[model samples]
Target: MQTIQALNQGAEAVDGEGEARVGDGTKVWLHWRATAVRNSEGKIDYFIAMFEDTAARHDVEVAAEANLELMQRLSALKTEFLQSVSHEFKTALIGIQGFSEFMRDADQLDLNDARAFASDIHRDAERLDRMVTEMIALDHIESTRANLRLSAVDINAVIEHEVAVTKISAASAIVTNLELKLPKVSGDEDKLSEVVRTLLADAVKYSPDGGRITVSTSVADGTVTVSVKDQGVAARADFDNRLFGRDELYASNPIRKVVGTGLGLGIVRQVIEMHGGRLWVDRVDGEGSEFHFTLQAVDASLVTPGGGRVA
Candidate 1:
């Protein structure tokens, strides 16, 4: 019909491209051209239409476009990561330098003043060390080079210890709902403690208004699940998937404030995954966020009488 219309409009040929489904319901890209087969009288006698399947070429073009987009996204993420790292390092260095200079320039520093200056320097140094450590840890885990000293870990004990440490300076109220006598899991105690600490710290950081932060643990189906729930700025669902990504420090939401180098959660994820566990986050009753991770619980039947694994 289009060819006939074009011919009646005094066109000798017409061509276009579109999509169509073949007999097997397979979608295909098609390019069609119609030419007027005219007699000597210069009037169109019949139309010769040709169709070419361009599915392969179309697929290649689509793939190339997608690859280009992915490259651009990665380049942008790299730029963001470098900028964040530099800013964090500079802030820490400035504090350390200022405190050191104050101590060095004081004509007659009292014992108390010297001690306070030393403390500030130490704190800033620790912050710098932590950032570097997280970067190294993340790289090791991602490269499958992290050496986990796996053993039967008492998760409850680990959680209690971390909670006590967090309460030392946490502004938010810390709460625990740990299940007693939960089965021990096979993991690195220190790394698991780090995970708990990271989550608790995040909970405290996000809940700037001072709300309840709950740390809970439970066991089911040979798996031990640990979760940290916070009544803070609730992250939108669209940002959930990117929460654990290395490039994402905080959501783009204006209400969600960015802090640190944003490597904590990424490190937490790598550590958990390296220990053969899975990590994820969820919305807390439509008000806040909850971070969860699962570890493989040791089988009770496989334990010896002396609290050791059976060979």
Candidate 2:
């Protein structure tokens, strides 16, 4: 009302500009404009008032704000990731240096004692090598996504092989309940195998004291889904309802004690996506977490009557 009165008194007023929801529950941002008209005698005559719908502009502003927030989060996570990587590298180097020094001062030690030192050195070197190799693999996955090798590969066979490998040194008891007749999926076999390996390894890593790890496969609505469940500690609060960022896996809480670059699941996710599939944490904050992913199942028509590939 004051704005209207101001316009009537020969003064123009353009106020009350913001957003609101109308009776139909649609949101709109309004930009109010008011102008006072004058007669020949310079006396105020009438007023013109206008409202412009600025909803689209307001939406753009909202989107920009969200983008800024996300960029900020990514920046912070990157710093954390670099720090974690540094710590891992330093630990490996320290082990190598310490064991070498011990060998230099143990000239009189027995042959068995000398072999133990060599083993320690080899173990540390392997740890460092694995770290560098994984970092390279992540870069390759990100840049060469379009070059993925496509073929009809058996997902069950991939699961079986990965489970056997993980059980070799896994403290946890690994088990599989695979559907043998499940359809093959079209994807890069090596990359798909890495996905399975990473998930199983992650399960064992989180359950250091040994627990049950189950790998399963199922089909529904033309999608082949695989799940890896572990009986480990529940995920931290940050990962309960959201996916972990690259550095989030190294969060200074419970996971800080767990050894990883925190990029394992992240890499797994991108690979699944490259195969036109999606991966997610199906269950968390429970007895343990279950990681599930889907891939396009090979069409039934593509297989011969004898359950063999048409080719």
RMSD of each: 11.8, 9.6
Q: Model 2, which residues run further than 4 Å from truth?
A: 1-83, 94-126, 208-210, 240-257, 283-286, 301-311
Instruction: Estimate every model's Cα lDDT from 0 to 1.
Output: 0.75, 0.73
By TM-score, the best candidate is 2
**Residues 1-311 of candidate 2: C-alpha lDDT, one tens digit per residue:** 87877776666555667887888998889887877778898777776778889888887887667555544544454455567678889988998999899888876888897898888888878777767876777667656666789989888878877887777787788877776567888899999999999898888877646578888888888898999888766666557333344234434535335445676676687678767788877556547878889999876733212322110
What is candidate 1's lDDT per residue for 186-279, written digit by digit as tens? 9998888989998988888777556788888888899989999887666556655553542243545344544466667866865676676888
For model 2, what is the alpha-carbon lDDT of residue 170? 78
Clashing pairs in 1: none
- Candidate 2, RMSD to the unseen true structure: 9.6
